[model samples]
Target: MYAVDSPPTPARSPQTPPAQHAKPVRRRSQREARVAWLLSLPTLVILIAMLAYPLYRMIVLSFQNMRLKELFSGATPPWAGFDQYTKALTDGVFWGVVGRTAAFTVVSVSLSVLAGLGIALLMRRVHSKVRIFMMVAMMFVWALPQLVAAQSFRWLTDSDFGVLNYVLTKLGLDYATHSWFVNPWEGWTVITVLVVWAGIPFLAISLSAGLTQVPKELLEAATVDGATPWQALRNITLPILKPLLTIVTTLSVIWNFGLFTQNWALRDGHPEPVYQTLATFSYTQAFGRSNYSYGSAIAVITVLLMLGVMIFYIRQMFKIGEVD
Candidate 1:
């Protein structure tokens, strides 16, 4: 057998130098990293300047004996250690305010979430036009300035010459123009109403969006399997909506916990403190009484409470993600 000479082995094109091949890729990666950092720079600067600095200052101030006088006089106050914290913790009014604030948060958030869920469910079944109208109405109330709404509601609920009393009398209801601020429960009721009104829109919008994301196919399949409407909602829709619910509820807790404007406006020039939420107490300590150190202590406590709540919420969110 004549062995045909093997065709000349194809000459391999000289491989591009490894450095040449890698250079462009390394340069491109560097360029991408630079671009990402450039895009993040503004947010980083703002957070450091606005959030970090203030937090640092607050922590420093909390440990000092600083007052408005010292601040204005530019004198660095001597450190007071944990005295301020101890005082705040031991104060009767402080503890009382804490309880009131807790009650306010729980009642208002619960009512708002319940109300929002009902409204969202109703809107889901309604015509798009009607849903839009209701959404706009809720948004209008939500978008109103907090101070403006507080003042307006204060006027409406006034014991003397108030429209609420007028309407009640007109409707032949027993209407006594008693001072609402004198009664802690009545004052809380008004505060709760204002908070619920402001809060419901957020929950409604969030829950509505969540509801919209519930797959029609899943519901249909559930129905095909003889599941009731309620069963389908509980098993499928609720599970899907949990993340949104957690987000809305956590946000509502934070917002309501820091409530000050409504409580202040609702006080309406009353001399005796009626509804003293934690925020109001902090404000009273800081500006009203010029006790900056004490105010900082209260603020720090409030911050810790909020942090705890957020941590719990984050844990729940991760737990939900892990659930099958």
Candidate 2:
């Protein structure tokens, strides 16, 4: 049998060792990490410069008894330890402000979310031209500065020469020269309305974007199975939109809880005690009453509260990322 040297045995190409392959990957990861840190350095420095020292000073101030005397004299204020915190915690007025802020946040967030969700759903069912028109209108409103919007609302709701008063009188209602702020409920209603109106555009646009991710096939299938629109929404649409909704709702809570510019401007830069929220309360205590340390204490408490909300938001965001 002619052992014709079986076609010269093909040489095996040299294989890279696993350890050798891993070295480049480790080096690449280290390089990427260095690049990321380098890119973030500017932001880190800015935050430390702008925020870190101020936050540290504020916290320190909260532990002192800094009043107008110390402020003007530029003298170190005496430390009160936790006395400022204790006073705030025990004070009825402080509690009232906290309660009012919490209540307004709940109401405003609920109204804004519901209205935004409704408008977003409505946009989905509308014709393309109509959707475009709605978007244009909302964009204009959203693009309008908050200060401008607040000023406009203030003008509209002016007690004497307001268009609202004029229209109400024309319609046979006795709204002529009527002060909306006379009643706390009425004043809050106006504030709530302004906040909701301003917030809706953002919420509507964001929710609308999220709604686009809903599976058309699932909706059609649900329809084919005789599911009502509401049923389809509850089962399919809402479930899909829940994460986005949570994020927006949490954001609204944060924004509305702050509750400063609207109330401040509406009341003409000096919100009344009845209209006082946490932000206004802190400001009033600090500048209006010159109780700097007390204001700092309230601000510290506010930050802690906000931190809780932020933690919740961060956790939800992480969950969304995992799902994706």
Best by lDDT: 2
TM-score of each: 0.81, 0.86
> Please, what is the whole-model Cα lDDT of each candidate in the order they appear?
0.85, 0.93
Worst 10-residue lDDT window for candidate 2 reads 315-324
Error of 1 at 214 (Å): 0.6
**Candidate 2 runs further than 4 Å off:** 1-49
Worst 10-residue lDDT window for candidate 1 reads 315-324
Candidate 2 lDDT tens digits, 1-324: 776666778899999999999999999877866866687689879989999989999999999999878888999999899999999999999999999999999999999999999999999999999999999999999999888888998999999889989999999999989999999999999999999999999999999999999999999999999999999999999999999999999999989999899999999998989999999999999999899999999999999989999889878875775466
- TM-score, cand. 2 vs. native: 0.86
Candidate 1's TM-score: 0.81
Clashes of each: 0, 0
